[model samples]
Target chain A: MKAPGYIFAEALRNLIKKRATVLYPYREVEKIHLPDGFRGKIEFDRPKCIGCQMCFRVCPAKAIEIIEDERGKRPIFLIYRCIYCGQCAEVCPTKAITLGKVFENVALRKEELEVR
Target chain B: MSFEIPIGPQHPIHVEPLMLKLKVEGELIVDVDIDVSYIHRGIEKALELRSYPQGLFLAERICGICNCAHSLCYCLNIEQLLGKEAPPRAKYLRVIVEELSRVHSHLLWLGHYFHTLGFETLFMYFWRDRERVMDMLELMTGNRVTTSYNVIGGVRRDITPEIDSKLRRMIEHLRERMKYYEAAIRSEPSLLGRLQGVGLLKPEDAIRLGTVGPHLRASGVKHDVRLDDPYSGHEEIPFNVITYDTCDCYGRVMVRIGEVFESLDMIAYALDHLPSGEYRLKMPPFFKAPVGESLSRVEAPRGELIHYSISDGGTNPFRYRVRTPTLANLASVAAMLKSRGDYEVYIADVPAILGGIDPCICCTARVIITDEGKKTRRITTLTELERYARERGVRM
Candidate 1:
């Protein structure tokens, strides 16, 4: 039973089968599969945020910054610094912050990545 | 002449920045010295600066492949410090995620191992299957790699019925694929030729040299953190500890493959017998831990991962130490690489030997300054390192 190239059959069989990987960028966006509750880009709601500084304190990466304005206090998220652990969303009392499925959050500039 | 050949710091064979100084007579390796001081990020010092909740995220980044284990161990350590334990349901949920991650890690290792051994076909096959487990992780924990699922006191998320069914389906698919892979591995002559009778380490040597996880299990030693300590409600879950007596690279491969099956079963069992209660406990985010020290151990896919922390009744830990399994297993690698009388190690066999332990060099990297002139070696703390740099007329 100790034959050489024993895995060749499975390898050949795989050639006939559908390709496992999705052509994410090259093909249609629908080809890529993102599961439900996939932690990706951070989405912040200004009005819903209570400005308890809860997200700032609990953020391990210090990705969230509190800015005081006429609308009381709101958090500006530095998305590049975010680890995407969804801790801010989990700790948000008003359900203001949520991790959206838009995983392709790359940007040319640092400012573009920030969510206020 | 026995020539000294340097393998890495950056080499094709090493996956990470690991330098192996090999003394070789022709192709036979006479002696070896391993250097893993390349990528020390000073995570322990960083943990000391962060609060318990924040430290959990930092801990998860310690090892990407074993992030679940790292976060779980950190959570367990902090929970112990806070004099609290996760509820029954949370514990079971933790076990499910832990085992799932274990399966994923083992599969990744198996694929990477074959790739190192120059078996690309099996490598592709293994990784193709690993995507299933990754998808399941995403489904259950909201993220794929850095799940960050385990927080202090309890887990971050609860499993839904849909996820539970998907998990069971993944388990079934993996089991079938694993069975085929196991048979293929056993029957394939080329893989067996590379693995068998290579990287030989006796059971006694495995223990004396402090090898852990599947590497130790492959040496016919029954030392598992899950089996021995039973943290995170592992005591309730019934699973067999797989061991192989070959004490070679073959045994190591077999032990990991066996562990994948065991992990699948454990996940299945955990899901079936999951208790119904509060998954997460209500706790203030920015609270101080009591003045005490707590140590936690988890059976990470690589080996036994140890996390120790000391609290000075502050928002952050006074001191934090992490003993990654790769660090413990590196000693055994040095032992295995040397050429014995009948047991010879060749330059060709280096990859087989090194990959057997599933070396995660970044996880194992720690800074130790050895003053050669003074003949003294000491581990420098972050403060001491800064002070030493200043004293040496080096600007920060």
Candidate 2:
């Protein structure tokens, strides 16, 4: 019911219109616009944190670790295994931790990923 | 050995290992039995051991392709369970991301299906085109693939003006390109000849087997979770539920292809009317739930993904169950496989059927061992020869 020879001509019409991709990072440092729920790095309030291990225990890959001292409670994220699910920020008992829009850090080595 | 032929668990066709024992009389398959549950990591079981917010992240990893959908569904379920509702702006943003994901995921499946059929040019064309959708997703969510956007009350960040403008431009470019795909479909006689009248699953057969998503819609079923039970501002976004009455493999593929354009229309609608307000509502960490059960369903790219959660007045969930569409739709494959004769024909049909529901092997199959089952000598994905050695060790 259809002709086979016209495949190339049809595909050519599609290719000629040009893709709409803009080089994002290079687009001069205007205000960096983002959508809702963008997974940025983890942020902690420090004051509201209740020292419970809700966030550290719940992280699937053990990305978040609870480090304690005289300062009450502190949690460090190993960014290498952080799948960016934001579980640590969400499960924070005291509403002390939240994810912010700042996912710029990149490290080649595993040790550079430790938040502590 | 007995007259048994095991087809998968490690085969060229299957995306994951799921062995099927075929008792054959010469070339004719007399008896067939499936061996699923081979790829199980108990993702639902993993979720139960965590709190509500902790469970959200684990849910997204259930399938990499529909990660956004998983997070959205989980977030909505938790929102319902918490006696809270997402604001209109947050709800609209959820619709945009979900529709964008549907476009990206369907095109991904198209590339893999064409690759399975040995059509290299078409495979490249589909994958190349799919990158545009990925760019749109990247603009919305920082990451290209694992975009865990939804939180308890609303989304995490906000869609800025620049991203919205870019999305609008991309939508305009794609609207015209969709016409070319339609033209290609009209012109390719070979593809039509192969696809039409093949792998016919009648209207009744599709419903009886609990088939969902485009597969059910292909058989002329007017049911869509979005239409039947609207969630996350899908009630406000204006889009039609695309369906066809043909009930063949060709119908299924065509319906999905056309739906990509429909999703593009949805993205435009969402961006134009993008609302304002605080992006997210905060939820308490250790609040006790009302000790009840709730179910939420979303029509994922594959099918309806239903999450059933039971909570008590505790930090962790009492029970969690996930009913993936692929697992439910796989019940229909045994019937579809019987019609095709010869090994090659059946093997080719395997990808089409498995792909029809956009099968995610990681979500569908689960391996459990009540006993060793005699330790039958077999091979694995590791045994398959590869030019590039896998980089396996992970430590910190």
Candidate 3:
């Protein structure tokens, strides 16, 4: 049973099978599998945030910055600095921060990536 | 004439930054020297600046492939410092995720190993199957590679009934694929030619060189951190330690494949016997650890991973040290690369030998000064290194 080219048969059969990867950028966006609760880009809800500074304190990457505005204190998330570990979302008392499924975080400017 | 050839600071044989100074005579390798000083991220020092909760993320970043093991070891070390243990349910959940990551890591290594050995078909097949495990990881944990699943008190999230069923299905599929690949690898003569008797390390030599993980197990020595010092509820799970007596590259491949099967079985068993209770203990985010030193050992996919920390009753550790498995196995690599008597090593066999240890150079990067004139090498402290550079008139 120590025959050479043993895997060739399997490879031949695989020629008919559909490709494993999807054309994500061009088409087949729906074909790309993203599981529920998948950690990706950061989304901040300013209304729900109590400005407890818990997210700022617990964030491993120091991605959250608290700023004072007309609505008391609110956090501005530097999405570029976030590791997407979801620590901020877990520690948020008011459930203000959540990791959305939008993993395509490319942006030209630093200001564009900030989630205030 | 014996010529000195450099494999890397950058080379195609391995991906990570590593330099192997090989002295070759004709086709035979006579002497070898390894330098892994590149890509040192200073993570140990960074851990000291961050608090316990923040340091967990830093620890998980030590190695992308074995992030689960690193984070688990860090949590165990900090939990010991706090003198608190995770609940029963959390421990079983930890085991499930830990084993799943282990399976994924082994599969990645096997596929990458074959890819390096010029077996592209096997490589594609292996990685194609690996996607299933990655999907399972993403389903169970939030992310895929850097799971960050383990926290100081326990796991980040509880396993849902849907996830449990999905995990079982993945395990079943992986088990079948692994069996077929194992049989294929054994019967394929070309693959066997490159693997069998390629990198020979005797049991005594393996132990003497301080090798750990599958590389050590492949030498016919039965030493596993899980069996010897069970952590994260590994004591409750029953599984056999797989070892092969071939004492070569073939054994290394076989040992990893066997481990994948064992990990699947362990996951199945853990899911069946998972205890029901509160998955996570309620603990504050930032807390001071007591003044004590704690050490933790985890059997990472590659080998033994050690994390040691000293807390000075502060929010951050006073000092932290990580001993990655790749660093320990580097000594054995030097031993295997040198040609001696009837056990000849050629230049072509370098990749086969180096890939056998599953080298992660980024995790093992450290500095050492070697004197060419004196033919001596010594590790220097940071202050000493700075002073040496200053005295030599190099701009600081």
Q: lDDT per prediction?
A: 0.91, 0.76, 0.92
Task: Give lDDT tens digits, candidate 3, residues B1-396.
Answer: 989999999999879889899999999999998988878798998999999999999999999999999999999999999999999999999988888898988988999999999998988988999999899899889788999899998998899999999999998999989989998998999999999999899999999999999999999999999999998788899999999999999999999999999999999999999999998889998899999999999999988999999999999999999999999999999999998989999999999999999999999877788799999988777799789889999732
- Pick the winner on DockQ between candidates 1 and 2: 1
True contacts kept of each: 0.89, 0.59, 0.87
Q: Judging by DockQ against the true structure, name the best candidate.
A: 3
State the fnat of model 3. 0.87
lDDT by residue for model 2 over B232-277, one digit each (tens)? 8888888898898888777888888888899999888988888888
The iRMS of the candidates, in order, is 1.4, 3.6, 1.2
lDDT of 2 by residue, A50-89 (tens): 7888888767678887788788767777877777776677
Model 3 chain B scores worst on lDDT over the 10 consecutive residues at B387-396
Please identify which of the two predictions, 2 or 3, would achieve the higher lDDT against the true structure.
3
- So what's the TM-score on candidate 3? 0.95
Regions of model 1 farther than 4 Å from truth = B370-396
Place model 2 in a CAPRI quality band. Answer: acceptable
